[model samples]
Target: MKTDVEKASVAMRELFAATPLQLNEHLSAKYGAQIYLKREDLTPVRSYKIRGAFNFFRKVIASGGSGKTFVCASAGNHAQGFAFVCKHFSVPGVVFMPVTTPQQKIDKTRMFGGEFITIRLIGDIFDQCYAAARDYVEANDGYMVPPFDHADIIEGQATVAAEIAEQLPEGVVPDLVVLPVGGGGLSAGVTGYFRDVLDERAFVFAEPCGAPSLKTSIATGEIVTLPKVDNFVDGAAVARIGDLNFAALKHFAADQVLLLPENAICQTMIEMLNVEGVVLEPAGALSIATLDQLDPQALRDKTVVCVVSGGNFDFERLPDVKERAMRYAGLKKYFILRLPQRPGALRDFLNLLGPDDDIARFEYLKKSARNFGSILIGIETRDRSSFPELLARFEAAGLGFEDITENEILANLII
Candidate 1:
């Protein structure tokens, strides 16, 4: 009998060609290791989610469960994948997404599914939308196709690992595999598959720092739900790991998972876009961002594979991504400056700026003050070191200012 992963792999070929496993020379050179990327971003729906969705639908049909309509709740890649599969199989599907989901994703899902699927926008967050979807599924006698948390989904996602195993040169096994963990479907599938096939291999999992569900769960030895999660890395900003997925991943140590800051992930996305012309969504860049956290000596001379999970990035978010990257790199800053109400006050402040410093934004917050006016200023510089020099000049000139670059509340309000 064929293993479930093998069967899923075979079944996947009917839907689309296997995503490429290509050696990335740039990453290899940077880390002094042979770096390979399992490019799940190249899938028909631009993510590995399709593998699980297809498998779920396939099994449902094969078991004479096709009479029921398939339902799912997602605002990201999973929705697109499920829609694509629905169209492919001519099965009816209902997708419930949060009202705040990007219009690009909504349009893409509609385009992929066409007449086979109906999209419902409800609620403000995933949890609320998910509850609505479940209610619909229960009331309508429909099948709830979970984005993760199911055995069939895990088995389907394992097809990615199956392809990796076959695509590598004969007898060549990767020394390390890095996976991005959201609700843990891809990580569970890939890790579980490797444990059975490879005798010795190291695994590193990456999760967004804002949503460290998997990392926190592994640390506490139990499933812990986060009260709040930042949705910047929308694809992998899961507040909790799936129950079945956690069970599969529980054997791994807490140290094996890396929590990546959202801004740093944006840096990785920008790097890939500028250097390799690869457009990766924030979650897709997680595995690559974790590379910076690895000890270079440990990874040196090792064969490493990083899963590029998805490329469904909206170009509309590019500006935000770039802004975050700049802030994370310390190349941009915002401040509130107290300037004297004098004719030469603005000129004196401008003189304090270094040669490489450029004022990106300057606005007078209030002009009512008799002695001094408050000014909101944003600065961009060629080097991070320029900030200290500029600040020193401000101190020497007796200028008063407060740096608000790292102050979330202030930055959000003013910058």
Candidate 2:
């Protein structure tokens, strides 16, 4: 019998063409290493999740499991993928998503599934929403299509690796393969396929800093759930790695995984859009973002492949992405200023700014004190060093100012 992954690879061609593996000259020159991006972002559902979803649906129908209703819980890419497959197969599906999910994703999922899928907005978090989906499956005798846990899903995702094997030039093997880990299906599938066919190939796993489930699990030699996950990288901010996926990835050393800060990931997204004209969602940029953490000397002249996971980014979040990127690069900051209640106070502060410095935000918090007022100021500058120079001027002028850029609570409230 043929391997499941081999069968899935043949089956996927019916849905869409294989995504490209393009060499990136810009990144290659910058890193002094050859870099190729596996553009899973260009999939029919704008994500690799569709591969697994389609395979799951196909296997179920082939095994005489047709006519069963399908159910899943997802706030982003997975839902869209599932919806697309549901419509393709002419099967009914129900997707449970958190109420807090962005309307853009919900609309996209709806568009994909059309009349074939029903979307239920339930609960405020994924856990609660997932529980509701599970209940529905049990109550209605529906088939639950899990995001990343099932063997069929893993086999389908491995098709990506199978394509890579065929697409690359004959007799060429990458020195390093980088994958972004959320629930770990993609990483596990790709790594398993490679480990079976190749010898001495290296793998790097990237995870959101806010949800380091894969890194933590690899370190502990078991699965570990994060107490809280920052959903900024919503596409890959899974709190826990799937059990089967963890078992597949457990042998890798902890050092092989890189935990990427949300802000840094934002910077990578911005860089790719601006420099390469590539649109990537936060999770899609994870592998590329981790490249900065690699040792330049070690990676020099090496062949590397970075999986560009998805492009399901909502344009509505562009401003937030830019803000986070600016803050991470230290080119923008917020300050709480205590200004003397005098006529020349504003003029004096204005003179302190450099030629390249621009005021992006200015607001008075309160004027209750007769002698002073609290002001919130946001400044953007040409470079990170400009901030230190501005702060020095503040010190020399005896101005009372507190850098609130790093204060998450206050920044969220005012900036």
Candidate 3:
């Protein structure tokens, strides 16, 4: 398997060169460790998925399946890779993407595949789209290039492990390797290739808290499908871990997987963009986010490598990202305040705000209420500690308010 991965990596030169595994000084200093980032984002398709797709296509053609039509379902990154491979191999293909997939991904897939592939927008979530793709494959006699699960796909993604092994600084042995998990292809491939060199305990997997398929499955010792999933982390929010991929990962305990919150991941994304000038999608930022969840003492003076899985970030989502980041940092909050329906009431509430407090939103829900009216308010402050003080001031001033920042249903409806 290791030899096959090396050969695949070498043959991959026809597509693109090996992505750099450069040390990240900012993260290294902060974590008190030598933190290296495997920049899979630098690929032509802006992700490591292309490696698997290229290998899958190459093997299919070599096996005398050149006339077959390929089909796949992906929320984003994998579709882009598959599209690129279809264009390169000059094979006809079809891509099925969820209707809710980001417009940036849809555009990129279309651009890369051009006339070689047809994209069908179906359903609103990945599972639904996947079902459609599977049906299409059976109906059309098309080969399915799964986003993860198959041996060829896993072998292709294992190239990342191969590259990291060869690219490490001389005489340096990594203490930990962090990887992001979606469908388990990348994590399975990476760990398989590193089985001889690294202890299984040295590997840590990160999954979105909203989508804990791999973590949940590993805990139950079976492939458990999630009943509901948050689509925020589009690339990594898989419903279930792939069967073959789970076989490779089942030996590890659930503790090996870190469940990251979507909001916290957003904070990491914003920090990376603002501090390091690095752009990453929610899924891509998972490995880096794992640093915050670790014991600092454990990472002290150790060498850690974070696999930055992808960088197909959509700039148009910056505002949403910033909103989530602020909430996660406790610097911004929303509330439904019951304000006295009088001229002096508004003035009183405004006077209660601290010097650093700024009103991001203020909307009266019932303007004509007799004595009290509900107002949806959003407040932003420089310090998170300031919110407690401001809330205290509200109480002392006899103002009635409810914090809706953490109330998903209310915030979604009113704010």
Question: lDDT for each of the candidates?
Answer: 0.92, 0.92, 0.93
Question: Candidate 1: how many backbone clashes?
Answer: 0
lDDT per residue for candidate 1 within 1-415, as digits (tens), equals 1288998899899999999999999999999999999999999999999999999999999999998899999998999999999999999999999999888889999999999999999999888999999999999999999999999999999999999999998988898899999999998898888886654338999999899999999999999999999988888988999999999888799999999989999999999999999999999999999999999999999999999999998898898899889999999999999999989989988888888999999898997589999999999999999999888988999998999999988877776
TM-score of every model versus the real structure: 0.97, 0.97, 0.97
Find the 10 residues in a row with the least total lDDT in model 2. Answer: 192-201
Model 2 residue runs over 4 Å out of place are: 197-201
Least accurate 10 contiguous residues by lDDT in model 1: 192-201
lDDT of 3 at 329: 98
User: What is the per-residue lDDT of model 3 for residues 1-415, given as tens digits with 9 covering 90 to 100?
Assistant: 9999999999998888899999999999899999999999889988899988989999999999989899999868899999999999899999999998778788999999999999999998767999999999999898999889899999999999999999998887789999999999999999999999998889999999999999999999899999988878888978889999999999998999999999999999999999999999899999999999999999999999999999998888889889999999999999889988778888989999999999999887875477889999999999999999998999999899999999988866765
Pairs of residues clashing in candidate 3: none
Poorest lDDT segment (10 consecutive residues) of candidate 3: 363-372
